[model samples]
Target: MEEKVYIQLKKKITVEHNHLIKLDHIAFVTGNVPYLEQVKNIKIYQITEQDKNVSVIDGFHLLDTLMVSYPKLAFDLIGPNQVIIEVKKQERKANIFIILFIWLLLCVGSAMAIMNFHYDVSMQEVHQSLSLYLTGRETEKPLWIQIPYSIGLGVGMILFFNHIFKKRFNEEPSPLEVEMFNYQQDLDQYLIHHENVLLKNKND
Candidate 1:
Protein backbone atom coordinates (compact mmCIF):
# COMPACT_ATOMS: atom_id res chain seq x y z
CA MET A 1 0.00 0.00 0.00
CA GLU A 2 1.20 3.53 -0.90
CA GLU A 3 1.72 6.18 1.79
CA LYS A 4 -0.99 8.87 1.71
CA VAL A 5 0.03 12.51 1.33
CA TYR A 6 -2.24 15.45 2.18
CA ILE A 7 -1.56 18.96 0.89
CA GLN A 8 -3.51 22.03 1.99
CA LEU A 9 -2.98 25.15 -0.13
CA LYS A 10 -3.31 28.71 1.04
CA LYS A 11 -5.61 31.12 -0.81
CA LYS A 12 -2.90 33.76 -0.91
CA ILE A 13 0.79 33.90 -0.12
CA THR A 14 3.32 36.69 0.17
CA VAL A 15 6.96 36.05 -0.70
CA GLU A 16 10.02 38.26 -0.82
CA HIS A 17 10.80 39.95 -4.12
CA ASN A 18 13.19 38.26 -6.58
CA HIS A 19 13.09 34.93 -4.77
CA LEU A 20 12.54 31.32 -5.79
CA ILE A 21 9.12 29.96 -4.78
CA LYS A 22 8.93 26.58 -2.95
CA LEU A 23 5.89 24.40 -2.31
CA ASP A 24 6.12 24.87 1.45
CA HIS A 25 5.82 28.65 1.05
CA ILE A 26 2.38 28.31 -0.52
CA ALA A 27 1.02 25.12 1.11
CA PHE A 28 1.09 22.67 3.99
CA VAL A 29 2.07 19.05 3.27
CA THR A 30 1.83 16.02 5.55
CA GLY A 31 3.16 12.48 4.96
CA ASN A 32 6.46 10.59 5.22
CA VAL A 33 8.76 12.94 7.15
CA PRO A 34 11.90 12.48 4.98
CA TYR A 35 10.07 12.55 1.62
CA LEU A 36 7.86 15.42 2.86
CA GLU A 37 10.88 17.67 3.42
CA GLN A 38 12.05 17.17 -0.16
CA VAL A 39 8.49 17.57 -1.45
CA LYS A 40 7.98 20.84 0.43
CA ASN A 41 11.20 22.44 -0.86
CA ILE A 42 10.64 21.58 -4.56
CA LYS A 43 11.31 24.68 -6.69
CA ILE A 44 7.97 25.41 -8.35
CA TYR A 45 8.51 28.96 -9.64
CA GLN A 46 10.81 31.95 -9.60
CA ILE A 47 10.12 35.68 -9.51
CA THR A 48 12.75 37.26 -11.75
CA GLU A 49 11.24 40.33 -13.37
CA GLN A 50 10.83 43.32 -11.10
CA ASP A 51 7.68 44.40 -12.92
CA LYS A 52 5.95 41.05 -12.40
CA ASN A 53 4.33 41.41 -8.98
CA VAL A 54 1.31 39.08 -8.84
CA SER A 55 0.81 35.49 -9.89
CA VAL A 56 -2.22 33.16 -9.89
CA ILE A 57 -0.90 29.62 -9.62
CA ASP A 58 -3.04 26.64 -10.52
CA GLY A 59 -3.26 23.80 -7.97
CA PHE A 60 -2.75 21.09 -10.62
CA HIS A 61 0.60 22.60 -11.45
CA LEU A 62 1.67 21.76 -7.91
CA LEU A 63 0.18 18.26 -8.22
CA ASP A 64 2.12 17.62 -11.42
CA THR A 65 5.36 18.71 -9.79
CA LEU A 66 4.76 16.50 -6.80
CA MET A 67 3.80 13.51 -8.94
CA VAL A 68 7.10 13.77 -10.81
CA SER A 69 9.11 13.52 -7.59
CA TYR A 70 6.97 11.34 -5.33
CA PRO A 71 4.79 9.28 -7.66
CA LYS A 72 4.51 6.40 -5.17
CA LEU A 73 2.53 8.48 -2.69
CA ALA A 74 -1.26 8.89 -3.05
CA PHE A 75 -1.65 12.68 -2.97
CA ASP A 76 -4.69 14.79 -2.15
CA LEU A 77 -4.86 18.57 -2.49
CA ILE A 78 -7.36 20.69 -0.49
CA GLY A 79 -8.40 24.36 -0.63
CA PRO A 80 -8.77 26.84 -3.48
CA ASN A 81 -7.95 25.66 -7.01
CA GLN A 82 -5.99 28.82 -7.74
CA VAL A 83 -3.58 30.52 -5.37
CA ILE A 84 -2.63 34.18 -5.54
CA ILE A 85 0.97 35.12 -4.81
CA GLU A 86 2.06 38.69 -4.19
CA VAL A 87 5.60 40.01 -4.05
CA LYS A 88 6.54 41.71 -0.80
CA LYS A 89 8.74 44.81 -1.04
CA GLN A 90 10.14 47.40 1.29
CA GLU A 91 7.89 50.31 2.20
CA ARG A 92 9.08 53.80 1.46
CA LYS A 93 8.17 56.90 3.44
CA ALA A 94 5.85 59.36 1.70
CA ASN A 95 6.72 63.03 1.55
CA ILE A 96 4.86 65.09 4.20
CA PHE A 97 4.22 68.00 1.82
CA ILE A 98 2.42 65.76 -0.68
CA ILE A 99 0.20 64.34 2.06
CA LEU A 100 -0.62 67.83 3.35
CA PHE A 101 -1.37 69.05 -0.17
CA ILE A 102 -3.80 66.22 -0.84
CA TRP A 103 -5.49 66.79 2.53
CA LEU A 104 -5.92 70.50 1.81
CA LEU A 105 -7.27 69.87 -1.69
CA LEU A 106 -9.89 67.41 -0.39
CA CYS A 107 -10.99 69.82 2.35
CA VAL A 108 -11.37 72.72 -0.09
CA GLY A 109 -13.12 70.58 -2.72
CA SER A 110 -15.61 69.11 -0.24
CA ALA A 111 -16.39 72.56 1.20
CA MET A 112 -17.00 73.93 -2.30
CA ALA A 113 -19.21 70.97 -3.19
CA ILE A 114 -21.38 71.53 -0.09
CA MET A 115 -21.66 75.22 -0.81
CA ASN A 116 -22.68 74.58 -4.43
CA PHE A 117 -25.29 72.01 -3.37
CA HIS A 118 -26.79 74.38 -0.78
CA TYR A 119 -26.91 77.18 -3.38
CA ASP A 120 -28.63 74.96 -5.97
CA VAL A 121 -31.25 73.83 -3.43
CA SER A 122 -31.86 77.38 -2.12
CA MET A 123 -31.03 76.22 1.43
CA GLN A 124 -30.52 79.76 2.78
CA GLU A 125 -34.02 80.91 1.80
CA VAL A 126 -35.50 77.77 3.37
CA HIS A 127 -33.56 78.46 6.59
CA GLN A 128 -34.74 82.09 6.64
CA SER A 129 -38.34 80.98 6.19
CA LEU A 130 -38.01 78.61 9.11
CA SER A 131 -36.42 81.40 11.19
CA LEU A 132 -39.48 83.65 10.61
CA TYR A 133 -41.83 80.94 11.94
CA LEU A 134 -39.66 79.96 14.90
CA THR A 135 -38.27 83.39 16.03
CA GLY A 136 -41.15 85.54 14.75
CA ARG A 137 -38.56 87.84 13.10
CA GLU A 138 -37.68 88.46 9.43
CA THR A 139 -33.89 88.54 9.16
CA GLU A 140 -31.38 88.20 6.26
CA LYS A 141 -29.28 85.74 8.26
CA PRO A 142 -30.66 83.22 10.74
CA LEU A 143 -27.44 82.85 12.73
CA TRP A 144 -29.11 80.81 15.49
CA ILE A 145 -30.51 78.07 13.20
CA GLN A 146 -27.91 78.20 10.38
CA ILE A 147 -24.97 78.04 12.80
CA PRO A 148 -26.27 74.94 14.51
CA TYR A 149 -27.14 73.33 11.16
CA SER A 150 -23.64 74.00 9.81
CA ILE A 151 -22.02 72.41 12.87
CA GLY A 152 -24.46 69.50 12.63
CA LEU A 153 -23.52 68.93 8.97
CA GLY A 154 -19.84 68.57 9.92
CA VAL A 155 -20.65 66.32 12.85
CA GLY A 156 -22.94 64.19 10.68
CA MET A 157 -20.19 63.70 8.11
CA ILE A 158 -17.76 62.56 10.79
CA LEU A 159 -20.32 60.12 12.18
CA PHE A 160 -21.30 58.82 8.77
CA PHE A 161 -17.68 58.07 7.90
CA ASN A 162 -17.25 56.61 11.39
CA HIS A 163 -13.81 58.22 11.71
CA ILE A 164 -12.23 61.15 13.47
CA PHE A 165 -8.80 61.13 11.79
CA LYS A 166 -7.49 57.57 12.41
CA LYS A 167 -9.83 56.99 15.39
CA ARG A 168 -13.05 55.02 14.84
CA PHE A 169 -16.20 55.54 16.93
CA ASN A 170 -17.40 51.92 16.79
CA GLU A 171 -16.47 48.46 15.50
CA GLU A 172 -18.80 48.76 12.48
CA PRO A 173 -17.18 49.48 9.13
CA SER A 174 -18.15 52.78 7.49
CA PRO A 175 -19.80 52.91 4.06
CA LEU A 176 -16.53 53.98 2.41
CA GLU A 177 -14.59 51.14 4.03
CA VAL A 178 -17.21 48.60 2.96
CA GLU A 179 -17.13 49.86 -0.62
CA MET A 180 -13.31 49.70 -0.65
CA PHE A 181 -13.32 46.15 0.68
CA ASN A 182 -15.79 45.08 -2.04
CA TYR A 183 -13.63 46.70 -4.68
CA GLN A 184 -10.55 44.83 -3.48
CA GLN A 185 -12.38 41.50 -3.52
CA ASP A 186 -13.63 42.12 -7.06
CA LEU A 187 -10.15 43.10 -8.22
CA ASP A 188 -8.58 39.97 -6.72
CA GLN A 189 -11.15 37.72 -8.38
CA TYR A 190 -10.53 39.39 -11.71
CA LEU A 191 -6.78 38.96 -11.41
CA ILE A 192 -7.13 35.26 -10.59
CA HIS A 193 -9.45 34.50 -13.54
CA HIS A 194 -7.57 36.61 -16.08
CA GLU A 195 -4.16 35.25 -15.14
CA ASN A 196 -5.40 31.67 -15.30
CA VAL A 197 -6.90 32.27 -18.74
CA LEU A 198 -3.65 33.78 -19.97
CA LEU A 199 -1.66 30.82 -18.65
CA LYS A 200 -4.06 28.38 -20.31
CA ASN A 201 -3.79 30.17 -23.64
CA LYS A 202 0.00 30.25 -23.43
CA ASN A 203 0.17 26.49 -22.78
CA ASP A 204 -2.17 25.80 -25.70
Candidate 2:
Protein backbone atom coordinates (compact mmCIF):
# COMPACT_ATOMS: atom_id res chain seq x y z
CA MET A 1 0.00 0.00 0.00
CA GLU A 2 1.17 3.53 -0.78
CA GLU A 3 2.26 5.43 2.30
CA LYS A 4 -0.04 8.33 3.14
CA VAL A 5 1.90 11.45 4.01
CA TYR A 6 1.74 12.75 7.61
CA ILE A 7 2.59 16.23 8.82
CA GLN A 8 3.08 17.51 12.35
CA LEU A 9 4.86 20.33 14.15
CA LYS A 10 8.13 19.43 15.86
CA LYS A 11 6.87 20.77 19.17
CA LYS A 12 3.51 21.22 20.87
CA ILE A 13 2.41 24.87 20.72
CA THR A 14 1.15 27.02 23.56
CA VAL A 15 -0.59 30.31 22.72
CA GLU A 16 0.54 31.92 25.97
CA HIS A 17 4.22 31.51 24.97
CA ASN A 18 3.83 31.99 21.14
CA HIS A 19 6.37 29.14 20.63
CA LEU A 20 4.73 28.21 17.30
CA ILE A 21 5.93 31.48 15.75
CA LYS A 22 9.52 30.19 15.82
CA LEU A 23 10.70 28.66 12.49
CA ASP A 24 12.64 25.96 14.35
CA HIS A 25 9.39 24.50 15.68
CA ILE A 26 8.38 23.30 12.19
CA ALA A 27 9.28 19.62 11.61
CA PHE A 28 9.21 19.34 7.82
CA VAL A 29 6.85 20.52 5.04
CA THR A 30 6.39 19.27 1.47
CA GLY A 31 6.51 22.88 0.33
CA ASN A 32 7.97 26.15 1.67
CA VAL A 33 4.91 28.41 1.42
CA PRO A 34 2.81 28.61 4.56
CA TYR A 35 -0.52 26.91 3.65
CA LEU A 36 -2.13 28.67 6.55
CA GLU A 37 -1.36 32.29 7.30
CA GLN A 38 -0.83 33.35 10.87
CA VAL A 39 -0.38 36.69 12.73
CA LYS A 40 2.74 35.21 14.40
CA ASN A 41 2.70 31.45 15.22
CA ILE A 42 2.21 28.24 13.16
CA LYS A 43 4.09 25.18 11.86
CA ILE A 44 3.80 22.69 8.91
CA TYR A 45 5.14 19.13 8.52
CA GLN A 46 5.02 16.03 6.26
CA ILE A 47 5.31 12.54 7.77
CA THR A 48 6.64 9.52 5.83
CA GLU A 49 4.42 6.85 7.39
CA GLN A 50 0.86 5.88 6.38
CA ASP A 51 -1.97 6.72 8.80
CA LYS A 52 -5.58 7.89 8.83
CA ASN A 53 -6.02 11.26 7.13
CA VAL A 54 -6.02 14.10 9.64
CA SER A 55 -7.21 17.41 8.20
CA VAL A 56 -6.12 20.51 10.10
CA ILE A 57 -7.94 22.86 7.70
CA ASP A 58 -11.11 22.57 9.82
CA GLY A 59 -9.31 24.29 12.68
CA PHE A 60 -8.37 27.10 10.28
CA HIS A 61 -12.01 28.25 10.38
CA LEU A 62 -11.25 29.63 13.86
CA LEU A 63 -8.48 31.75 12.28
CA ASP A 64 -10.43 32.63 9.13
CA THR A 65 -9.01 36.13 9.23
CA LEU A 66 -5.46 34.70 8.98
CA MET A 67 -6.33 32.22 6.19
CA VAL A 68 -6.00 33.19 2.55
CA SER A 69 -9.31 34.12 0.87
CA TYR A 70 -8.64 31.83 -2.12
CA PRO A 71 -8.60 28.06 -1.26
CA LYS A 72 -6.76 27.36 -4.55
CA LEU A 73 -3.67 29.10 -3.16
CA ALA A 74 -3.30 26.31 -0.53
CA PHE A 75 -3.52 23.54 -3.19
CA ASP A 76 -1.03 25.32 -5.44
CA LEU A 77 1.38 25.90 -2.54
CA ILE A 78 1.03 22.84 -0.28
CA GLY A 79 0.70 19.34 -1.75
CA PRO A 80 -1.94 16.63 -1.01
CA ASN A 81 -0.36 15.79 2.38
CA GLN A 82 -2.71 16.42 5.29
CA VAL A 83 -1.26 19.28 7.28
CA ILE A 84 -1.26 18.81 11.09
CA ILE A 85 -2.40 21.96 12.87
CA GLU A 86 -0.50 23.25 15.86
CA VAL A 87 -2.52 24.95 18.55
CA LYS A 88 -2.33 25.92 22.19
CA LYS A 89 -2.69 22.87 24.44
CA GLN A 90 -3.79 22.89 28.07
CA GLU A 91 -1.22 21.09 30.27
CA ARG A 92 -0.67 20.69 33.99
CA LYS A 93 2.32 22.39 35.63
CA ALA A 94 5.07 20.33 37.27
CA ASN A 95 5.06 20.03 41.05
CA ILE A 96 8.30 21.52 42.35
CA PHE A 97 7.76 20.05 45.85
CA ILE A 98 7.44 16.49 44.52
CA ILE A 99 10.40 16.98 42.17
CA LEU A 100 12.58 18.35 44.98
CA PHE A 101 11.51 15.52 47.30
CA ILE A 102 12.44 12.80 44.73
CA TRP A 103 15.71 14.56 43.87
CA LEU A 104 16.64 14.80 47.57
CA LEU A 105 15.82 11.14 48.12
CA LEU A 106 17.94 10.01 45.16
CA CYS A 107 20.87 12.20 46.19
CA VAL A 108 20.76 10.99 49.81
CA GLY A 109 20.44 7.35 48.74
CA SER A 110 23.34 7.56 46.28
CA ALA A 111 25.55 9.37 48.80
CA MET A 112 24.85 6.78 51.50
CA ALA A 113 25.58 3.88 49.11
CA ILE A 114 28.87 5.46 48.02
CA MET A 115 29.86 6.17 51.65
CA ASN A 116 29.04 2.62 52.73
CA PHE A 117 31.01 1.13 49.83
CA HIS A 118 33.97 3.39 50.65
CA TYR A 119 33.85 2.37 54.30
CA ASP A 120 33.82 -1.33 53.34
CA VAL A 121 36.64 -0.96 50.80
CA SER A 122 38.62 2.28 50.63
CA MET A 123 38.49 3.32 46.95
CA GLN A 124 41.21 5.95 47.51
CA GLU A 125 43.69 3.34 48.78
CA VAL A 126 42.69 0.93 46.00
CA HIS A 127 43.31 3.63 43.42
CA GLN A 128 46.71 4.42 44.96
CA SER A 129 47.73 0.72 44.91
CA LEU A 130 46.54 0.29 41.30
CA SER A 131 48.33 3.45 40.19
CA LEU A 132 51.59 2.36 41.95
CA TYR A 133 51.37 -1.13 40.37
CA LEU A 134 50.76 0.29 36.88
CA THR A 135 53.11 3.31 36.92
CA GLY A 136 55.82 2.04 39.37
CA ARG A 137 55.31 5.31 41.30
CA GLU A 138 52.04 6.81 42.53
CA THR A 139 51.15 10.50 42.43
CA GLU A 140 49.65 12.31 45.42
CA LYS A 141 46.18 12.14 43.80
CA PRO A 142 45.10 9.25 41.55
CA LEU A 143 42.79 11.80 39.84
CA TRP A 144 45.42 12.15 37.07
CA ILE A 145 44.57 8.66 35.77
CA GLN A 146 41.04 8.37 37.23
CA ILE A 147 39.76 11.59 35.61
CA PRO A 148 40.80 10.60 32.07
CA TYR A 149 39.47 7.04 32.56
CA SER A 150 36.15 8.41 33.83
CA ILE A 151 35.89 10.74 30.82
CA GLY A 152 36.69 7.81 28.50
CA LEU A 153 33.94 5.74 30.15
CA GLY A 154 31.29 8.39 29.32
CA VAL A 155 32.60 8.80 25.74
CA GLY A 156 32.59 5.01 25.25
CA MET A 157 28.99 4.80 26.46
CA ILE A 158 27.86 7.51 24.02
CA LEU A 159 29.69 5.85 21.12
CA PHE A 160 28.22 2.42 21.91
CA PHE A 161 24.62 3.61 22.49
CA ASN A 162 24.40 6.48 19.98
CA HIS A 163 26.68 6.18 16.96
CA ILE A 164 25.56 9.01 14.67
CA PHE A 165 26.32 12.31 16.43
CA LYS A 166 26.46 14.94 13.61
CA LYS A 167 23.64 13.56 11.43
CA ARG A 168 19.98 12.96 12.38
CA PHE A 169 19.91 11.06 15.72
CA ASN A 170 16.11 11.23 15.71
CA GLU A 171 15.18 10.15 12.12
CA GLU A 172 17.44 7.16 12.70
CA PRO A 173 16.72 5.28 15.90
CA SER A 174 19.51 4.52 18.37
CA PRO A 175 20.72 0.94 19.18
CA LEU A 176 18.46 0.78 22.25
CA GLU A 177 15.56 2.12 20.19
CA VAL A 178 16.12 -0.48 17.46
CA GLU A 179 16.09 -3.22 20.12
CA MET A 180 12.84 -1.83 21.52
CA PHE A 181 11.30 -1.78 18.02
CA ASN A 182 12.23 -5.44 17.46
CA TYR A 183 10.85 -6.34 20.90
CA GLN A 184 7.55 -4.62 20.08
CA GLN A 185 7.40 -6.40 16.71
CA ASP A 186 7.92 -9.77 18.42
CA LEU A 187 5.25 -8.93 21.02
CA ASP A 188 2.72 -8.10 18.29
CA GLN A 189 3.48 -11.41 16.55
CA TYR A 190 2.88 -13.31 19.81
CA LEU A 191 -0.38 -11.44 20.41
CA ILE A 192 -1.64 -12.40 16.95
CA HIS A 193 -0.64 -16.04 17.54
CA HIS A 194 -2.47 -16.12 20.90
CA GLU A 195 -5.61 -14.58 19.34
CA ASN A 196 -5.54 -17.20 16.57
CA VAL A 197 -5.21 -19.99 19.15
CA LEU A 198 -8.20 -18.61 21.10
CA LEU A 199 -10.31 -18.44 17.90
CA LYS A 200 -9.36 -22.07 17.02
CA ASN A 201 -10.41 -23.22 20.51
CA LYS A 202 -13.79 -21.46 20.13
CA ASN A 203 -14.36 -23.12 16.73
CA ASP A 204 -13.50 -26.59 18.22
Candidate 3:
Protein backbone atom coordinates (compact mmCIF):
# COMPACT_ATOMS: atom_id res chain seq x y z
CA MET A 1 0.00 0.00 0.00
CA GLU A 2 1.19 3.50 -0.81
CA GLU A 3 2.35 5.45 2.28
CA LYS A 4 -0.07 8.18 3.43
CA VAL A 5 1.63 11.48 4.16
CA TYR A 6 0.36 14.83 5.36
CA ILE A 7 2.51 17.94 5.04
CA GLN A 8 2.35 20.98 7.30
CA LEU A 9 2.15 24.34 5.64
CA LYS A 10 1.58 27.83 6.94
CA LYS A 11 -1.99 29.14 7.07
CA LYS A 12 -3.46 32.62 6.60
CA ILE A 13 -6.08 34.19 8.87
CA THR A 14 -8.01 37.45 8.76
CA VAL A 15 -9.77 39.41 11.46
CA GLU A 16 -12.39 42.15 11.24
CA HIS A 17 -13.99 44.46 13.79
CA ASN A 18 -15.38 47.92 14.21
CA HIS A 19 -13.26 50.65 15.70
CA LEU A 20 -14.46 49.58 19.15
CA ILE A 21 -13.42 45.93 19.23
CA LYS A 22 -10.05 44.25 19.77
CA LEU A 23 -8.69 40.83 18.95
CA ASP A 24 -8.47 38.26 21.75
CA HIS A 25 -7.53 34.79 20.50
CA ILE A 26 -7.95 32.40 17.60
CA ALA A 27 -7.88 28.59 17.29
CA PHE A 28 -8.08 26.12 14.45
CA VAL A 29 -7.94 22.35 13.87
CA THR A 30 -5.08 20.72 12.06
CA GLY A 31 -5.18 17.65 9.81
CA ASN A 32 -2.12 16.22 11.52
CA VAL A 33 -2.55 14.13 14.63
CA PRO A 34 -1.36 15.93 17.74
CA TYR A 35 2.24 14.97 18.39
CA LEU A 36 3.14 13.66 21.81
CA GLU A 37 6.87 14.19 21.23
CA GLN A 38 9.30 17.10 20.89
CA VAL A 39 12.25 17.13 18.50
CA LYS A 40 15.03 19.77 18.56
CA ASN A 41 12.81 21.85 20.88
CA ILE A 42 9.99 21.70 18.32
CA LYS A 43 6.67 19.94 18.86
CA ILE A 44 6.58 17.31 16.11
CA TYR A 45 3.56 15.17 15.24
CA GLN A 46 2.60 12.90 12.39
CA ILE A 47 -0.19 14.05 10.10
CA THR A 48 -0.43 10.80 8.16
CA GLU A 49 1.49 7.59 7.54
CA GLN A 50 4.10 9.48 5.54
CA ASP A 51 3.65 13.15 6.51
CA LYS A 52 4.20 15.18 9.65
CA ASN A 53 3.35 18.51 11.26
CA VAL A 54 5.79 20.85 12.97
CA SER A 55 4.83 24.05 14.71
CA VAL A 56 7.26 26.92 14.25
CA ILE A 57 6.76 26.91 18.02
CA ASP A 58 9.45 29.40 18.84
CA GLY A 59 7.90 31.94 16.43
CA PHE A 60 4.19 31.59 17.26
CA HIS A 61 4.25 34.38 19.80
CA LEU A 62 6.46 36.45 17.52
CA LEU A 63 3.64 37.56 15.19
CA ASP A 64 2.52 41.11 15.93
CA THR A 65 5.34 41.10 18.44
CA LEU A 66 7.31 42.72 15.66
CA MET A 67 5.62 46.08 16.18
CA VAL A 68 7.36 46.36 19.51
CA SER A 69 10.38 44.10 19.01
CA TYR A 70 10.70 44.35 15.22
CA PRO A 71 8.65 47.05 13.53
CA LYS A 72 10.16 46.47 10.10
CA LEU A 73 9.25 42.80 10.14
CA ALA A 74 5.74 43.61 11.36
CA PHE A 75 5.11 45.90 8.42
CA ASP A 76 6.45 43.36 5.94
CA LEU A 77 4.25 40.58 7.29
CA ILE A 78 1.06 42.58 7.76
CA GLY A 79 -0.40 42.51 4.25
CA PRO A 80 1.06 39.20 3.09
CA ASN A 81 -0.10 37.40 6.22
CA GLN A 82 -3.80 38.22 5.57
CA VAL A 83 -4.24 40.33 8.66
CA ILE A 84 -6.98 42.95 8.68
CA ILE A 85 -7.01 45.90 11.05
CA GLU A 86 -9.93 48.25 11.50
CA VAL A 87 -9.66 51.32 13.61
CA LYS A 88 -12.73 52.76 15.25
CA LYS A 89 -13.65 56.28 14.29
CA GLN A 90 -13.33 58.73 17.10
CA GLU A 91 -15.57 61.74 17.60
CA ARG A 92 -13.46 64.87 17.81
CA LYS A 93 -14.65 68.11 19.28
CA ALA A 94 -15.40 70.87 16.84
CA ASN A 95 -13.70 74.25 17.21
CA ILE A 96 -16.46 76.84 17.11
CA PHE A 97 -14.03 79.72 16.76
CA ILE A 98 -12.38 78.09 13.78
CA ILE A 99 -15.68 77.45 12.04
CA LEU A 100 -16.90 81.00 12.60
CA PHE A 101 -13.59 82.46 11.49
CA ILE A 102 -13.66 80.50 8.24
CA TRP A 103 -17.20 81.57 7.52
CA LEU A 104 -16.34 85.21 8.22
CA LEU A 105 -13.30 85.14 5.95
CA LEU A 106 -15.28 83.57 3.11
CA CYS A 107 -18.03 86.14 3.45
CA VAL A 108 -15.57 89.07 3.62
CA GLY A 109 -13.57 87.88 0.61
CA SER A 110 -16.71 87.34 -1.43
CA ALA A 111 -18.09 90.73 -0.45
CA MET A 112 -14.84 92.45 -1.38
CA ALA A 113 -14.87 90.90 -4.84
CA ILE A 114 -18.54 91.64 -5.42
CA MET A 115 -18.21 95.25 -4.25
CA ASN A 116 -15.16 95.86 -6.46
CA PHE A 117 -16.94 94.51 -9.52
CA HIS A 118 -20.35 96.11 -9.16
CA TYR A 119 -20.03 99.30 -7.12
CA ASP A 120 -17.63 101.24 -9.38
CA VAL A 121 -17.11 103.51 -6.38
CA SER A 122 -14.02 104.46 -4.38
CA MET A 123 -13.20 102.55 -1.17
CA GLN A 124 -13.20 105.87 0.70
CA GLU A 125 -16.83 106.43 -0.09
CA VAL A 126 -17.70 102.94 1.14
CA HIS A 127 -15.76 103.49 4.36
CA GLN A 128 -17.34 106.89 4.94
CA SER A 129 -20.83 105.46 4.52
CA LEU A 130 -20.05 102.54 6.80
CA SER A 131 -18.43 104.71 9.48
CA LEU A 132 -20.09 108.12 9.07
CA TYR A 133 -19.94 109.14 12.74
CA LEU A 134 -16.57 107.47 13.54
CA THR A 135 -14.70 109.07 10.59
CA GLY A 136 -15.72 112.64 11.44
CA ARG A 137 -12.79 115.11 11.35
CA GLU A 138 -11.50 113.76 14.71
CA THR A 139 -9.84 110.68 13.10
CA GLU A 140 -6.04 110.93 12.61
CA LYS A 141 -5.62 107.97 10.18
CA PRO A 142 -6.02 108.66 6.44
CA LEU A 143 -8.47 106.64 4.33
CA TRP A 144 -5.57 105.02 2.36
CA ILE A 145 -3.87 103.86 5.55
CA GLN A 146 -7.13 102.57 7.01
CA ILE A 147 -7.94 100.50 3.91
CA PRO A 148 -4.54 98.81 3.77
CA TYR A 149 -4.58 98.25 7.51
CA SER A 150 -7.99 96.63 7.36
CA ILE A 151 -6.91 94.33 4.54
CA GLY A 152 -3.78 93.34 6.45
CA LEU A 153 -5.80 92.69 9.58
CA GLY A 154 -8.26 90.49 7.68
CA VAL A 155 -5.45 88.45 6.11
CA GLY A 156 -3.71 88.03 9.46
CA MET A 157 -6.93 86.90 11.09
CA ILE A 158 -7.53 84.25 8.38
CA LEU A 159 -4.00 82.86 8.73
CA PHE A 160 -4.28 82.70 12.52
CA PHE A 161 -7.62 80.90 12.42
CA ASN A 162 -6.36 78.35 9.86
CA HIS A 163 -3.42 77.52 12.10
CA ILE A 164 -5.75 76.92 15.00
CA PHE A 165 -8.01 74.75 12.87
CA LYS A 166 -5.16 72.47 11.89
CA LYS A 167 -3.93 72.21 15.46
CA ARG A 168 -7.34 71.13 16.70
CA PHE A 169 -8.34 68.71 13.95
CA ASN A 170 -5.15 66.89 13.02
CA GLU A 171 -5.24 64.50 15.96
CA GLU A 172 -3.27 61.28 16.22
CA PRO A 173 -4.88 57.85 16.31
CA SER A 174 -6.09 56.65 19.70
CA PRO A 175 -4.30 53.89 21.61
CA LEU A 176 -7.12 51.47 20.83
CA GLU A 177 -6.28 51.47 17.11
CA VAL A 178 -2.67 50.56 17.73
CA GLU A 179 -3.64 47.67 19.95
CA MET A 180 -6.26 46.34 17.53
CA PHE A 181 -3.88 46.47 14.58
CA ASN A 182 -1.28 44.47 16.46
CA TYR A 183 -3.84 41.90 17.54
CA GLN A 184 -5.18 41.41 14.02
CA GLN A 185 -1.67 40.93 12.71
CA ASP A 186 -1.14 38.01 15.04
CA LEU A 187 -4.32 36.31 13.89
CA ASP A 188 -3.25 36.71 10.25
CA GLN A 189 0.06 34.93 10.84
CA TYR A 190 -1.62 31.93 12.41
CA LEU A 191 -3.97 31.57 9.47
CA ILE A 192 -1.11 31.83 7.06
CA HIS A 193 0.73 29.01 8.76
CA HIS A 194 -2.27 26.70 8.49
CA GLU A 195 -2.77 27.53 4.80
CA ASN A 196 0.86 26.78 4.01
CA VAL A 197 0.51 23.38 5.64
CA LEU A 198 -2.56 22.51 3.59
CA LEU A 199 -0.79 23.54 0.39
CA LYS A 200 2.23 21.48 1.25
CA ASN A 201 0.04 18.40 1.72
CA LYS A 202 -1.64 18.91 -1.66
CA ASN A 203 1.70 19.11 -3.46
CA ASP A 204 3.04 15.99 -1.78
C-alpha local distance difference test of each model: 0.82, 0.46, 0.40
Better of 1 and 2 by TM-score: 1
Candidate 1 deviant stretches above 4 angstroms: 32-34, 196-204
Maximum-lDDT candidate: 1
Which is the better candidate, 1 or 2, if ranked by lDDT? 1
Runs of candidate 2 exceeding 4 Å displacement: 1-127, 133-135, 163-173, 197-204
What's the lDDT of the predicted structure labeled candidate 1?
0.82
Off by over 4 Å in 3: 1-86, 119-204
In candidate 2 the C-alpha lDDT for residue 34 amounts to 48
Q: Give the alpha carbon lDDT tens digit for every residue of 15-86 in model 1.
A: 888878888888887875556787788887777674277887788877877787877777899877777888
Compare the candidates by TM-score and give the number of the best one: 1
Residue 94 shift from truth in candidate 1, angstroms: 2.4
Ranking by lDDT: 1, 2, 3
TM-score of 2: 0.34
